[model samples]
Target: MKAELDLARAFALEEDGVTAIEYGLLAGLIAISIIAGATAIGGGLNQFFTGVGNWFSGITVP
Candidate 1:
């Protein structure tokens, strides 16, 4: 019974579990920001390349 009580006390005072959860949340936020920035940049690049292609197509090679 004494050992069980000590074990329970140790678990209650531990901070590693809470720290891991905080790190997980931080990592998730970082990943979300990266995904959003990449999506915006990808759309802009696609539009820029399409415009360049259209301009090239309008040229006469004569």
Candidate 2:
């Protein structure tokens, strides 16, 4: 009975699971921020490239 009680106490005091969960959440947030930033940058780049292509297409070459 004493050993069982000690084991229960050890389990209760352990923080490994909580720490892992916190790290997982942090990683998820970082990934979300990276994706959002990439998406915004990609849209801007696409527009800039499209404009450049349109300008090039307007040029008349002999």
Candidate 3:
């Protein structure tokens, strides 16, 4: 019984659990920010590059 209680106490270490959760949340936030920024700028960047390519193709720059 004492061993079981000790094991439970170890498992219940609040600092470890909190740290794990904090890191997980931080990673999640970072990933979401990357996705959001990519989505917001992806199309415009692609369009600008495509336009530049067309401009260099001796065709009118649209």
TM-score against native, each model: 0.82, 0.89, 0.60
lDDT of 2: 1.00
What tens-digit string does per-residue lDDT give for candidate 1 at 1-62?
99999999999999999999999999999999999999999999999999999999999999
lDDT against the true structure, per candidate, is 0.99, 1.00, 0.92
Indicate the residue-level lDDT of 13 in model 3: 77
TM-score of 2: 0.89
Q: Rank candidates, lDDT, best first.
A: 2, 1, 3
lDDT at residue 27 of model 3 (Cα atoms): 100
Residue 14, candidate 1: C-alpha displacement in angstroms: 0.4
Q: What is the C-alpha RMSD of each candidate to the true structure, in Å?
A: 1.6, 1.0, 4.5
